[model samples]
Target chain A: MEIVRPTLLLDKETCLRNIARMAEKAKAKNLDFCPHFKTHQSAIIGEWFREFGISAITVSSVQMAQYFARNGWTDITIALPVNILEIDQINQLASGINLNLLVENKESLVFLDKFIKFQAGIYIEIDTGYNRTGVAAHKTNLVDGLLEIVKNNKLLDFKGFLSHTGHTYQASSRHDIFNHHFDALLKMRSLKNRYKKDWPNLKLSLGDTPSASICDNFDGIDELRPGNFIFYDLMQYKLGTCKFEDIALRLVCPVIARHASRNEVIIYGGAIHTSKDSIINIDGKELYGQVIINQNGQKILLDERNYLHKLSQEHGIIKVTYKDFNSFKVGDLVEIVPVHSCLTANLMGSYLTSDGEYIPTIRQA
Target chain B: MEIVRPTLLLDKETCLRNIARMAEKAKAKNLDFCPHFKTHQSAIIGEWFREFGISAITVSSVQMAQYFARNGWTDITIALPVNILEIDQINQLASGINLNLLVENKESLVFLDKFIKFQAGIYIEIDTGYNRTGVAAHKTNLVDGLLEIVKNNKLLDFKGFLSHTGHTYQASSRHDIFNHHFDALLKMRSLKNRYKKDWPNLKLSLGDTPSASICDNFDGIDELRPGNFIFYDLMQYKLGTCKFEDIALRLVCPVIARHASRNEVIIYGGAIHTSKDSIINIDGKELYGQVIINQNGQKILLDERNYLHKLSQEHGIIKVTYKDFNSFKVGDLVEIVPVHSCLTANLMGSYLTSDGEYIPTIRQA
Candidate 1:
């Protein structure tokens, strides 16, 4: 059961616990949970959600939706704004599953009308001040035009409204994120009230990792979709979303070489495993990630004075300030907590469970 | 066979031409070409090198070596310092292929001695001022200790000295990169001379994308191991490594939605496709990449005044200028040349060939 160092180690227990916690929160709030699958795109991982009585999911692309759809996910909301160029795939997906699409403009609705045959729920994404995606909430005419096109079409169905407050991730504190989420929900509620007389059964959905993790109140929300909670990373820690112990994934790396003069220790893990994602450490120092306890399970931070400053394709350079870098001799296995687990997991390709179990990751093209 | 937008498109012809060009360069210089597989990481792509008469190949990991080994690549040099924790896999790999290991110190040589049974070629990695990995060239004692360990271990064969002038990538111009490469070569030559009496058969190996792309001289080096030339990217263009047209990979994305007031467009492509890698534009503007003419293959500067400014997991926000905002409607497809092709290709799991062909990428993990 000797797994290779610099490999991804997934704790199944923590993973299940994370999923259950999110599911429980959604259940308690009476909100439909459509967890974003982009965080962990494994079908095996999706099956774990099925165990929680979850039938619906969210994916980033049509290819990802098709992946989950083939694996028995019945209802899938393509969280991204529906690109009309892939309307053919949307038609195929809708014919099979309850495929809900997101659109921010009337132009997409007009394009979707050309290809869609079955009634598909369309979620109009509103940009509630997050300058990323979605149409501005005040753009009522755009919504009206979209609704008119949907009403005219035989296959299109106007579901409601959706928005992702992605800017919350950049929030400096919990209060900032909570306020952002609350304000976003208020905007969505106002949009819903504006169209409630016309469309009484309209659904209001909002999703974002920062808002979903910190905000406890979802009083007016209809559905919740957050992905990164499955494997909280260093960013989540910085955002006060999760504690360091809650991180479910770690890169197991081995000390390959050490330089005495520079007090730098080279490890097998590099940008490929830990990714280029970095954050300022506790000492206000920039570091790729904290060096966790090695095989001994002693979470030893390799001298705070030293930092993993640079990474090559396959080698990590840990600049140590301590004179005795020899403590971590060649062949010693070490674990690195990646700055971003989603990107790291995606880059690493597969994972080995804590119990020496190997889980091959499904490729998302 | 209309392919999905926001997909990586590869020109097989261009790839073959690039491979042939590198191979011809090595042949003319009488240098052994062990092209690093970290760039392509594809067996099919490696086959093109074999077609061009390349027998030796370089990989970043033992796992990668195993991947290429399975695909009939025999002479493989694992470019990173050997992690003894993966000795079992290395032993298994050595049994099947002509495996060579990289080491910077005697500690790694001592650690590797216990597991290797057959004589494995060990390449001493010298740091020619890169300060990333490898032992400093001035450290003759470290090299002596490494040689002593090789002399004591019957199973280990001292192959040569290797150095990756990785700092060349950070060079300001072609002249800077050329000087960096030249200085690294001179350092390697001095080290070779220092060990000439002890190891007369020692080979000199040098590699780096910037060095290979910018420097025409490979005079003193025994082998070349550049990888990024197979698929150039935005960083390469900025480094003066390749032209805009020479870039072999592009993310073909579909315009999903548009915002009129802000004059912004949302595309299906995001950080997952093009990566979070960004570069400063000509006007000291920071941008992820330039949008290309969708069908015409023309480079569209994306109205530099308004370019792809931000990216979420699966959503790319293109801030459009007020003037050209109305010209781009939903359903339009756009192509984006990525900032870092290696990371983009790794993220993009597969590629859509130029002739409407779908090619699934081989997973190296």
Candidate 2:
């Protein structure tokens, strides 16, 4: 609470605005807004979504689903392809709540069919350009195989096709994001058209912050589950998805040392606090994070040259410009805009709200 | 204990051997072995060093110092530049134990001189080429000013010059590592020679796993404080510091999906478990970790092409060769040799020993 070490400061106002904007976008499009809880991972923040008429939630793992289910969230979906090894825990969660699981292959479906004792919704994970996971959208045969097993099991309920357009994160421009999202939409729509006769009530779910924030075409998307929008970071800003002011988190670290000869400032934050997530700057060097000096009630964002350059276990070296080197001193509290807020939030395990209240996340809970 | 999720498996026999080897190296050279505990921030692992006559320990932060001190480690050195903001905790630790803090500038010494209530040893951090922190070794005037403040304070005991040649991690070859270590040695020795007359007993401390593992030069060095040698990783292997067998830790993750079209295997282990630390492989691609499949009572290290290629929040995409693709199946547990063990260990918070014992790290403790 005293801010002696590197602490993540969460601006409650910015986060509430982010949540409201995303919820409004989903409402206008008539889409079920099942925002992913993987970013914030806090039950308190999840409770804030209830005021916007949001009930359903999405998580990346079964452990997260159980955590939210215990907190009174009934409708939950585990977004990752189901790890069959965790079927026991999945079965336990399904027995209590309306749980949905993602399956990309028949192996996981067969395992679920044989082991699950309670009713669980199954969403076929379709790969639409994002080759991270999921079945290829064109591969209807694999989809038919997975559905056949689900149809035979009375405890399994067929939901719909789910896809994560993660490749939008690599978009070089707004045009690139639009093009990738359109291509993915076509692929997902083709599958929906082919299976509409058998599954008339099926839903299509798509997620990823880039396309969800920038692209306006949610032609066939039934639900939106963009997680990082809750705390848009430098990566989202670089991808043209969010503005700098939308970033709701900043790592507050104390400047421990200042080296004028080399024009560097050392801070207590490092790779352990902010994971080694970086972006290539204009100078073709790895920029870990942007620095901001809040002095005299004014927040001054340092120039491009004064960024977090190197990180060790507990030491972050910021390459300060000659013009800004004298502005820092020992024990000065500096703020670093993290490149990826999700990883930083995961590492810090908890957050200090703008009003100084402690918000405990899943890691602590 | 069931290990259904991504769990770090520690081979205790390998860790014990690593501890003995580094302790023997320090003994053979008559150097005081104060091994760095930042790599394995475990009180259980700290107890392992006691069997090898390692009484003094080195840590990276005041919190780690307190954690070890609570675990009965009397003598400890926080190897990072002193964060004057934590003067209260520093004073508390110094009052109870033999604590030493690293200082690079005069401001922190002045802070310590004014507020420290108990005797605390001081190490003047000298920059020998690692431009991350510390004063330049040749800057005698800066060193004089820092010592002047320490000499005037009765509670501060001047230990000596300490150098962390961390630049050796970027060495092109073992010869380059030797050159960097030798250059750092000359600079530290120069400072010691100039100050030996004023302070009769000043010990030169040096650390860095690359130099401690490969370079056979310990002339004029009194203490060795390398940490990562306790659990050698893929980065150390690439640096020619240790063999694959010496890597004691592995993230054992369950295989969730296998895509034959992309020749990729998606595992439950990901950036959250492995910490996105990578090295460029021979094919000019990022290699996150090496894949090792332990099936049918045999461990097989896949080829370079089958390395863990991509990482998401909770998913790892391992690009497998055609020959190695068929060997994997859904629900099979595979091991990933992490890129940087320290970050991985810190992220995991706990470890599962090969003998099925649970070991809690500092983050857990």
Kindly report which residue stretches of model 1 are placed more than 4 angstroms away from their true locations once superposed. A282-286, A295-297, A301-307, A321-327, B283-285, B295-307, B323-327, B355-359
What are the per-residue Cα lDDT tens digits for candidate 2 across B134-202?
A: 989888999999999999989999999898999998888888899999999999888888999999899
For model 2 the local lDDT of residue A350 reads 92
Off by over 4 Å in 2: none
lDDT of 2 by residue, A1-365 (tens): 69999999999999999999999999999999999999999999999899999999999998899999999999999999999999889989988999999999888888888899999999999999889889899889988888888888899999999999999998898899999999989998898899889989889999999998988889887999999999999999999999999999999999999988789899999999997989998789999899999778899998889999899889999998899998899989999999999999999999999999999888888
Candidates, DockQ: 0.64, 0.86
Clashing pairs in 2: none
DockQ score of the complex predicted as candidate 1: 0.64
Error of 1 at A65 (Å): 1.3
* Tens-digit lDDT track of model 1 for B58-127: 9888878888898899899999888777888889888877899998877677778776877689999999
Determine which window of 10 residues in candidate 1 chain B has minimal summed lDDT.
B294-303
